[model samples]
Target: GESVGLHLPTLSVQEGDNSIINCAYSNSASDYFIWYKQESGKGPQFIIDIRSNMDKRQGQRVTVLLNKTVKHLSLQIAATQPGDSAVYFCAETQGRAAGNKLTFGGGTRVLVKP
Candidate 1:
């Protein structure tokens, strides 16, 4: 089993600006990565994802980048808004050998100021 959330990082941005959130994953074997946004008292909502074979993936207003060389991942939000303020996390999962289990990073809180 993998551990989740050892600590938290914070990101602040002004409304209509762009926000970047970073994460470091623990397993090099992890082949899939997802970015999630969680508001207070709610479960994480999926934002975007990238596979190990791909370096980048983009969604409506979000982009996910993976750097397997450093085992690092980053999420970029375009035109950040007050509604984008939330705790963002990166989750990784490998094949069935690891039960395809999902492991989440500590997470970064994004604050959008008016």
Candidate 2:
């Protein structure tokens, strides 16, 4: 399972510290990978994506690193802010030629202590 996270889904910070969230994927058949952030009571918002052909991707103050060798992925938020608090989910997409379907992993939560 690429769903590696601590329960309680929270980080008590001073509102200006950087935060690191982690995940572990279990599918070897997966190809395209993406990270999404979901705020309270809202749907996930696209963050960044990395392909199996790549190892790392970055956007704004966020950086996503992928280690396909270990089937692991991580998201790093710089200068974590109160608005960054939300649940994060790592999704693995491998087109199912049989039915054209996509798969997703469980999500992780991030709590910003502002």
Candidate 3:
């Protein structure tokens, strides 16, 4: 499914140090990817993105690595902080009219230690 937003609400923990969330897309033609960080009670905010032509993209504290071969993506955040605590979402978009149009991945709730 393309451009699906938080159709469901949920939350959990970060455990000792790390956690991994997974997503499956229904479209095979989508060409770009983005990860967004939305704090509690706030709208989603952009974190990072990678195009179909690329396999990985990195940011200051985040990395968006894409596996076009499998239509898979993952984000890495270094030094998870309490401020980093939020609902994280990944999105994919096709490069055409309404190209800016986006479909978001199911979100993950991340908790940080004090």
Report the C-alpha displacement of residue 65, candidate 2, in angstroms. 0.4
Compute the lDDT of residue 58 as modeled in candidate 3.
70
Over 1-114, each residue of candidate 1 has an lDDT whose tens digit, in order, gives 222322556787999999889899999888999898988777889888788999998889888899999999999999999999888989999863544678998888888999
Taking all chains together, each candidate's TM-score versus the true structure is: 0.88, 0.82, 0.77
For candidate 3, write residues 1-114 as lDDT tens digits.
233335544444453444454555557888877888887566779887788888777788677777766778887776566677777888888885654889987777666766
Q: What ranking emerges by TM-score with the best candidate at the front? A: 1, 2, 3
**lDDT accuracy of residue 9 in candidate 1:** 67
Q: Least lDDT summed over 10 consecutive residues: which range in candidate 2?
A: 1-10
The residue-by-residue lDDT of candidate 2 on 63-95, one tens digit each, is 999998999999889998988877788788785
- Deviation (Å) of 39 in candidate 3: 1.1
Ranking by lDDT: 1, 2, 3
lDDT by candidate, in order shown: 0.86, 0.78, 0.71
- Candidate 3 Cα deviation (angstroms), residue 76: 0.3
